[model samples]
Target: MNNPNQFIPTPYTNSVDSGNFTWSAPSNIALVKYWGKREPQIPANPSISFTLNKCKTITTLSFERKRHGGFSFDLLFEGQPKESFKPKILKFFERIESYLPFLTDFHFTIDTRNTFPHSSGIASSASGMAALSMTLMSVERLLNPEMTDDFFYQKASFLARLGSGSACRSIKGNLVVWGEHEDIPQSSDLFGVEFPFEAHEVFQNYRDTILIVEEGQKSVSSTVGHDLMNGNPFSEARFAQARTNLTRLKQILIDGDLKSFVALVESEALSLHAVMLTSNPYYILMKPNTLAIIEKIRKFRSDTNVPICFTLDAGANVHVLYPDEYKGVIKTFIDGVLSLFCEGGKYIEDKIGNGSELLTVNS
Candidate 1:
């Protein structure tokens, strides 16, 4: 229950000061999935992910002193006011209020936008929550100038996890692991850490082209999915299997074992949906085209000897992962074959990113 990066600080700057903070956080596709959770948004199983580019959320927080000491905020999506998002934003602030006690002293104007559509099935919550966390932390940095960059992200990751479990991973770039695993050093249940070992160059520039099979909200929310795991018959076995996979994956990444990487990545993706399918009141998130895309990816890999593979989130979209060397061939395959299966022939061409970024007013 001990969190090493707990935030407890007295204000070091004037409470009457006003400023704006902006940050862009990327959405990550879990290479090893974190399906269920425990208290305080701790992962039931360990997860590792590839930080994505292009698909991200940018959040800006402009703060001003409140006349009376109480919290207030306006939530804006893109550029317009969004009432539906206000409740979730309010709830997130409430959860993290203890970590940032100065919230009640100011009124905030928050503006957020996503590069990809919410209907695209990318983990928007992961990117969105991380952006908000980083923006808030930037404010904290202004108040207390002594905070280090490393500690800033560590606390940002911890705060983001409290809002959404997968969000912690979005705070770091390249590959990140979230959960307390013995095989991984410095791993914790409270926040995500950048994968500690050196990654092979092959994976360093890997591309992720998201195929949107269903462009709408999912039937079963991730919250409900995690709740079902409480009584899941295979919960214990799944957790054990995840631990084993994390250990194997770490070695594969370091050794540049592409074949093993493909097998493990594909298997983990299927296993995630499999658990959902076998739950008590089973629900299937995959659409008809989802299976078709997977089949095509397998056939393409077999025929061309490319290292392309697919992974899925808690929704029906497909994340096609491959190396940079095969970019031309992959794009051709997408345009000629895969594009036909896409919803309105739309798929995002994004690569593994250098992690998230902060955009200041001066910058």
Candidate 2:
């Protein structure tokens, strides 16, 4: 499972002319953010994330034998034809075609929908690519009925990473780690692994309330931002810092240290933005409301002695993270205070969830 070549499928034992698969994959919020990446979508640093429950993507992929060659596919977003999405999917197919050799064998119809907005900084790529990868793996399973559950999921994650690096983390549950870290022996740069150690009960069912600061495409796409890190002055130090934070955060999770958790998580979030700002052709993703929400979160935690903290992705939206026990108070605070900073008073309530699910399979 550690070798990339192992994911390449052998000749199929069974063949099907037509089939369809449906899967739902949840988005994840990285506690230790993965900013820059290497080629083929490998993260520059190790990172861990909380798999979110409510914000997800559900996709159905149907395939039929085609007479012509090349990767043929039609994409639909929420039941409407979406031509703009085809280019990304085409690129994904090119990246994964070697692993799944059936790419050109059939014409595919991919129908995808999301619970949240498409490019609103919610890691839609993570959930969307993860769901599509899961569905593709389902088709692989049918072609090779003897595939083990372990191998199936591993390859699914591996393929998802080719599409989006964070998408690999979306393949599994509550806590997942990606990238090679010395402390985590089983951790691989190939795909994300479920956190092996037992996290304290306090970390269980962690709540993440997303305050939507802006809802459209980001000013800087993650791809462009990641590319800027190529010659970034702070890149090496930032990667090293992430590794150290991950090691410390592992202990925090084990010991149920909410205080330390808040510190590390918030630091990682800010560091991610710092790297962006320091990159050549500097840019800022956090909007005014983003900073406003962060200030309010810190002040509220200071005033109420709550463990509440906030984290940001590569976008302006803020994900307010806290333990499940404080939901009632935090909800009140979010509703009364944080919601105002959000666009149209929009926010999504979510919590740590078990990863992706196979919604349906037909052959």
lDDT of 2 by residue, 1-363 (tens): 357998888899998899999999999999999988988888899999999998999999999988888999999999999999999999999999999998899999999999987755689999999999999998888889999999899899999999989999999898999999988769999999999999999998799999999998888888999999998999999999999999999999999999999999999999999999999899998999999999999999999999999999988999999999999999999999999999999999999999999888888
Give all TM-scores, in the order shown: 0.97, 0.98
Clashing pairs in 2: none
Candidate 1 lDDT score relative to the true structure: 0.89
lDDT of 2 at 314: 88
TM-score of 1: 0.97
Give per-model CA RMSD: 1.5, 1.0
Give residue 27's lDDT in candidate 1 (0 to 100): 94
Q: Across residues 1-363, which tens digit of lDDT does each residue of candidate 1 receive?
A: 247436666656634368888899999999999988877787899999999988999999899877787569999999999999988888888888888888887899999999999888888999999999998888888777788998899899999998889999999888999999998899988889999999999999999999988898899999999988888899888889899999999999999999999999999999999899889899999989999999999999999999999999988889999999999999999989998899999999999986679888521
Tally clashes: model 1.
0
Candidate 1 regions exceeding 4 Å error are 1-5, 10-16
